[model samples]
Target: MRLFEDNIHIEIPGRSTPSARSPEAEPSLDGKVNSVSRREAVEAFLRLRLFMPERQKRIVATCMNGEERQYFFDKMVEIAATVEGMPVTYQQDGNGDETIAHLHYFLGDCHWYITEKDREGEVEQAFGYAILHGDLINAEYGYIPITELVDTGVGAELDFHFKPTPMAQIKQALEDRYG
Candidate 1:
């Protein structure tokens, strides 16, 4: 197998702070929905469980910073430690289903995800996401599918498949020319 390195940094659009929900003092970044707070923007984004458009259903994007990113990362490490390469899928409502065969990565970052309604015989409706840490001011800022990212990374070590070969073939082909 030929191994290659990818350092594809994505250019995400900056989300300007939207108007506050109520008429009062403008909330600080930390207090806003996009804030690092548990009830902030990150949570809201997680709720919809968006799938990248059909054109790039395999792609996804998430952002966070300050305590939020760190907290998420640390929690990921802990959750990963307990899992034994179980096939898992996360839901917007915090529910997840486990399967016996699949690929994934950990501590992983997603700048964007391209979605695909089907992945081989998996029949999954969605497929990729990119984790990002913008807002240089904050030390932590990212959005990643904890299970997918973590499992993909530890896949081989735990005796399971990482990313699907078909997907990798496409990704590698893109990288060879212009991923």
Candidate 2:
């Protein structure tokens, strides 16, 4: 599959490998040839983690050497430094139908649909709808410190399969499920 717009290409084995190109034609990171820029590679890696099916990830993993995998992970940390978290006002200016929840954190029967985040404060806070212990009646929109969720031990997990969804839809789904 084509990984970048540049001449550098990686063909999934079983498919034909492109004829040898000049060593000077490929981009190099620490003297190793790479088909894409570090940022693009890292972005692709993140997309793979979030969006690719588990089977697909296994297929891709089989294609990468341990060194290549390590390089991508190391670069991911460096690239993620510049990426911004959810802003405090994220989706707040919009109605429920327009506001989107971009993150999902869950522990047992508790679920947090995180629509916004405040990183400017000393303690990071997330704003969203929270349902605790399946209590739909008490579920409401509010802020919670991110540390609280992180400190919830190993039970809490960020749902990697969650897609950004409108708050209205999420609310309706919860109502339908819990009512």
Candidate 3:
């Protein structure tokens, strides 16, 4: 079955039935797909889940069974662990200096500019400036759990085009644009 399309397109094999046709094919980066297991297909779907819109998510959810949903979360945790967190030095420096935000997460007017992360902790926590619904007065640097951003229903998205930028510069830009 054809999942969805974006930068990369994935087509997982459908079940065996007389009515079932061959999976609609989409070449990956390498342009080859000899075979794909159900687990692998689910993994690919979860990896791209963050970037997908709410409508697409609902559609995908309907296609997935309870087992697949559980697998998706388990795989997500594994994937999260592999992601490189903020450096120890950055955490130690605190928010005193003009720290660089290495990651940007956004959904509509809300934005999370991640500066530091506690990699050693059981639950991944990011220290960053958050501006929710353009509330500049309330926006402040604080701990934001990575899990919150990855929640399937939340629809939060990581800005793939964002580059590391100074918090001061970001603040200045926000002020110039919003003020």
Best by TM-score: 2
Please give me the total number of clashing residue pairs in predicted model 2. Answer: 0
Candidate 3 per-residue lDDT over residues 1-179, each given as its tens digit: 43433425335565333124223232333656324444664665665464344655565555444323333333333434333444532564755537888777888899988776655533356778899998888899888876666574766776645677888899988888777
Give the local distance difference test score of model 1: 0.30
Q: Best to worst by lDDT, what's the order?
A: 3, 2, 1
**Least well predicted 10-residue stretch by lDDT in candidate 3:** 18-27
Q: Give the TM-score of candidate 1.
A: 0.19
TM-score for candidate 3, residues paired by index: 0.53
lDDT of 2 by residue, 13-127 (tens): 6433444433223434465655444455556556435323344345445433232444444443432332234446554755666687867778789988877766543335678
Candidate 2 positional error at 116, Å: 0.8
* lDDT for 2 (candidate 2): 30
lDDT of each: 0.30, 0.58, 0.60
Which 10-residue window in model 2 sums to the lowest lDDT? 75-84
TM-score against truth, every candidate: 0.19, 0.54, 0.53
| Superposition TM-score, candidate 2 onto the true structure | 0.54
Task: Give the range of the ten consecutive residues with the poorest summed lDDT in model 1.
Answer: 92-101
